[model samples]
Target: MPTYRTTAVDAVHNDEELRLNLDLLEGRRERAAIREAKAKLQMTKYYNARVRGVTFSPGDFVYRSNDASHDVAGGKLGPKWEGPYEVTEALGDGAYRLRSMDGTILPRT
Candidate 1:
């Protein structure tokens, strides 16, 4: 009971093609929306953290690292953290000198 020429095409070609395309596009859109939501949620959580990272300047006193594992000259193998060392001068980034216990100051970098 054929009423149209469908010998070389699908019997319901137009309707089926449109439906398949729509289904595929809808799946893509939903995936994109879900990805956006996840990214936003992650960013919000990251921004909400009360991150505390501060630095000090020259002539400030800071607790010297007391790690006993940093000794090339057996420096850290003694105390956990020694001095509330007076940061005599900052050499630029993170290097500093302590006003020595015997008054012989030198940069400890």
Candidate 2:
């Protein structure tokens, strides 16, 4: 009867192969991260370039849209805009505290 060996003798080569595979994966991860960062920067730049800022000041005459309560007379077919309200105060970020032409404070939307 003859005995056959069934064990690997190249343990060093296996270790080297594993180390190389790990290094390759690490490099791929670094490259992917860099690409993602560049793409985010491009998106930010594009949006900033195209975005327009709107500002409102006190005492500005602006129109107000009719609310749901206004639909009693006109219903869906009624007028959409109702006001030439005056801006009493600039609340920043395009918001304003408004007053009616009669000087009555309107509710904030």
Best by TM-score: 2
Tell me the TM-score of model 1: 0.38
Worst 10 residues of 1 by lDDT: 67-76
Largest lDDT belongs to which candidate? Answer: 2
lDDT of each: 0.69, 0.81
Query: TM-score of each candidate?
Result: 0.38, 0.53
- Checking candidate 2 for backbone clashes, the offending pairs are none
Candidate 1 accuracy as lDDT: 0.69
Question: Candidate 1 at residue 13, lDDT?
Answer: 79
Candidate 1 segments exceeding 4 Å error:
1-49, 68-78, 107-109
Question: Where does candidate 2 stray beyond 4 Å?
Answer: 1-23, 64-82
